[model samples]
Target: MKKLLSFCLGILFTSTLVAGEVGSDCTFKGKKLSGKVQFVTSFPDFKVQIVDSFPDLKVQKVNSFPSDCGKWQEVTSFPDFKVQIVTSFPDIKVKYVDSFPGVP
Candidate 1:
């Protein structure tokens, strides 16, 4: 009985850890990380931090064709998603690259 309980607890812990991981698919917390993005000071859909290495997503800023994952187009009026640049406590960490933008 004790061994069974330990096994169940271990499974639960592993699942919990996996649930918080962000994949290369560019989706986090059910929010898709593509399309036109707006930078805002407040009331953002996601808060992100720019990093030099070990990023959750590799981002490429584009003028058009933000349809693919990790591609973002900056817009003011109509945005598919809004993000706030934060120094700390970001929802995800990203690295801006010139090419090959996607989950890494």
Candidate 2:
């Protein structure tokens, strides 16, 4: 019985240690634009996607990084929106892009 209990505790601790965390300070502030931007996890890397939004919704990406995330961007704009960060941070890095380029 004791052995089983110890095993369960070990598993619980290990699982908690492997949990993922996302970092982003996005307030998703906008009138016609109301969307939040943040990271999901930094396991392998980040991902990107571009889809149509509501009317006049300006999805402007600022290319941001969490203060605790330890990401840096001397210059913005990456290759595939999934920019790989070069920092030793526990959290992931992120940046902003005008996902919503406003109306024409």
Candidate 3:
């Protein structure tokens, strides 16, 4: 019984370490989106916002990982579009992606 308990605790600890975490990973309001969209940025894990105005925004995560990652860029076509990720207190960066369709 002692051996069983020890093994269970060991596994729990291992899983916790292996699981990658997101610090403030959730986007503006905890939503994901798809659209006639393409990519201007990429990350292994990210939170995406779709529109300029708040309230009806969306978030997106990636599956095209381990192949082509570590790329982030600006929204070329939608030059007026904007996105912000929390940096420090009262600070954020606006990085938007030009999403057209099936590219991201």
Clashes within 3 Å, all models in order: 0, 10, 8
Question: How well is each residue in 1-104 modelled by candidate 2, as lDDT tens digits?
Answer: 99999999999877644312231332112111222233333432343233232221223444454122222223323322222333332222233333423331
User: Ranking by lDDT, best first?
Assistant: 1, 2, 3
TM-score of each: 0.77, 0.24, 0.26
Candidate 1 per-residue lDDT over residues 1-104, each given as its tens digit? 99999999999876644313456567987878899999999999878889898788889999998998999999997898898998876778889999998888
- Model 1: weakest 10-residue lDDT segment is 15-24
Tens-digit lDDT track for model 3 on 1-104? 99999999999977644312212432222322232123334431222333333212223333332121212323335321233343222111222333322222
Question: What's the lDDT for all of these models?
Answer: 0.85, 0.32, 0.32
Candidate numbers, best TM-score first, in rank order: 1, 3, 2
* Model 3, C-alpha of 26: deviation from truth (Å): 19
Q: After superposition, how far is residue 59 of candidate 1 from its true place, in Å?
A: 0.4
Checking candidate 1 for backbone clashes, the offending pairs are none
**Higher lDDT: candidate 1 or 3?**
1
Model 3 spans > 4 angstroms off: 20-68, 74-104
